[model samples]
Target: MTDEDRYELLGEIGRGAGGVIYRARDRDLGRDVAFKLLRREGSTLDARVRFVAEAQIPAQLEHPNIIPIHDVGRTRDGSLFYVMKLVQGQTLKEHLNGRTSRSELLFAMLQVARGIAFAHHRGVIHRDLKPSNVMIGLFGEVLILDWGLARPTRGLSTARDEHGGTMTLDGDVLGSLGYMAPEQARGEVHRQGPPTDVHAFGGVLYELLTGRPPRHSRTLGELIPRLNELPEPAPGPLGALASRCLAPEPGARPQSGEELLALLERVT
Candidate 1:
């Protein structure tokens, strides 16, 4: 059988800044799958390390909402590739392109919070938790994808706080600009724990309600002050919870992802 015929490569599914994803099928297993192929230009040592780390992260996690990594290996040309369950759906970012109802928003965020809580309990922090990273399937499944920037800080840390996890080595900002925590924007080398993930969740909730980012500013210098001193949106339970979750100080935010989920349930 031809390589393509041996294992069917159906078509391209998605593309990201780091790699391209494809829909495939396992000929032996008789099941559909997805493959993530890293860009050739970014297949350097650091990139390969990051890719392997991501592949292993999900293997360590056994949660319904978190996407599980199925396999990983290097291509003959030295390119890196990984496989995962093929989830057929658009991202939360895509779902929010137009008007979104409150119940719909709450339903989506609930799945995200549950998944993140599972990761947090396992001592894994998803440094990148944005709408684009959340996939909502047609079969009523929400899968949290991408862990290239996850930080595992259970009992390991250093003065610089590099806990040997799949972290960004270049000190490049981890989270997306609008969803990043205040301390993260400062380039602080602190060990990202559960609280960091909570902050990003809050940002997601804010955008879900208002159809805009929680902290909006042109530059980092401008964003810090806005995040610190910005007034609460309005008189609503979800709005109040959003403010608390997006608190400038991580200490002022929810202690864990589970706590945030509880609060969302109460507010919703």
Candidate 2:
């Protein structure tokens, strides 16, 4: 059936370079769905391609932590769009507006890490890992969102990603500046992989501890100098863990989600 025939557009809930997310309803199934419509005008070919990956990548991985995809198709206007389960809680960004107890923070982070690990097991590398893209459901389900920049690891490929010559992620700084790893910010796609994601996850952990992004210094000029400042010998265990993850060299950081989860569990 056609997109319009199946889902009714209720209203816009969010917007990003990938496209607009509408709070839609599946007429036949009688349930709410988040619909992302790829913009036709003002969208470059790469953006459209990433929009396809954003719709498809996450749909391939079936984990409780990864947002699930329900349907995908083109609209009557020939615009690409996809439907996914509607989350009912705030983003990790919104949820982190203020600090919570240490235990609560660690629990949420562990779940987030588990989700990342699950994706990694499926050969998916979430190049963009940040609080804004992570949704914490009302029932405490932590979901990783936005797979537009995600890439396949060695010996892995998805049906949607292989649809055309569109599998290669951009060599530009295709991730959120503040949360990106140094290599990612440098547009060195060749050096990007699991370590890149771990470093960014460390940045997230740092944010959780300090309530500020560790990579706040954006540009290389500012970031390089600030990295020299070091973390000032970490005030506590959590701080130390974050410090390890935020190390300038990706190799020095936790290499895998499992390793991170184990280390963070010890500190927690």
Candidate 3:
């Protein structure tokens, strides 16, 4: 069957700054799948490279909690496209809209921690861990979405744009503002190691527990200092652990994602 005959293009599922995701079905496979079509219409060389990087990353990583790559292909006009198992669930952000029991939320985040820890062990830093990137399915399965920003840190320098912020060189910010670490926002290449993911994870947990990030600064300058000075609102040992993870100094944060996962499991 042809493109039109093989898959019916259902409406978009989510729109990110980098790509537009659609809910489509595979006629051959007889199942629903999500297609992330790269927006390369007016992209520069660097942007195209990053888009290809995103496609390769997910294809490489195979984990139960991570969305499974079904297929990677291109359109007749040359747009980059890839398919993944269409997750049936709401984003963690959506799940937090109403009141829910604390036990239920902790259980949900625990799965996220496990997934991140697993990915970190494989030398993949999510770089973009936020509520919207987490999908909670009906059977309590958590799927980490969009490995688009994941970078292999073997020797390649942290990518950046002209403005000195973390970017793909084509000048698009890879992650969302509210969830990005201070160093990531400054375009400081040296400071964007795995610990940056730890900091973002802390922000996600903070938002889950308290309904807001620990630091609410509207700008990068405003956010960095507040990370050190202000105390997190999360109660008990979890609050202390989160504070350590969100420390302004990257070295002061957890040494690895596994360490942070251990702390979270110990607390809840």
| TM-score leader | 2
User: Per lDDT, what order, best first?
Assistant: 2, 1, 3
Off by over 4 Å in 3: 1-5, 155-174, 219-228
TM-score of every prediction relative to native: 0.87, 0.91, 0.86
Candidate 2 at 15: error in angstroms? 0.7
* Alpha carbon deviation, residue 4, candidate 2 (Å): 2.7
Write one digit per residue (lDDT tens) for candidate 3, span 87-198: 8878888887756567877788888887778777877777888888888898878888877677666532332322243345323234666677767766676667778889
Candidate 2: segments with Cα more than 4 A from true spot: 159-164, 167-172, 218-229
Weakest 10 consecutive residues of candidate 3 by summed lDDT: 155-164
Q: Is candidate 1 or candidate 3 better by TM-score?
A: 1
Q: Which pairs, if any, clash in model 1? A: none
Per-residue C-alpha lDDT of model 1 across residues 1-268, encoded as one tens digit per residue: 5333435678998887668888888797789999888866746655666667777787778899999887776665667788898888888998888565768767988989999988888888888899999988987789999987776666323222433444454533656878888777776657356888888888888888777877666677677666576445745888899888888788989988888888988877
User: Which segments of candidate 1 are over 4 A away from where they belong?
Assistant: 1-6, 39-42, 155-168, 217-227, 231-234
| Candidate 2 lDDT score relative to the true structure | 0.79
Candidates' C-alpha lDDT:
0.77, 0.79, 0.73
lDDT of 2 at 133: 89
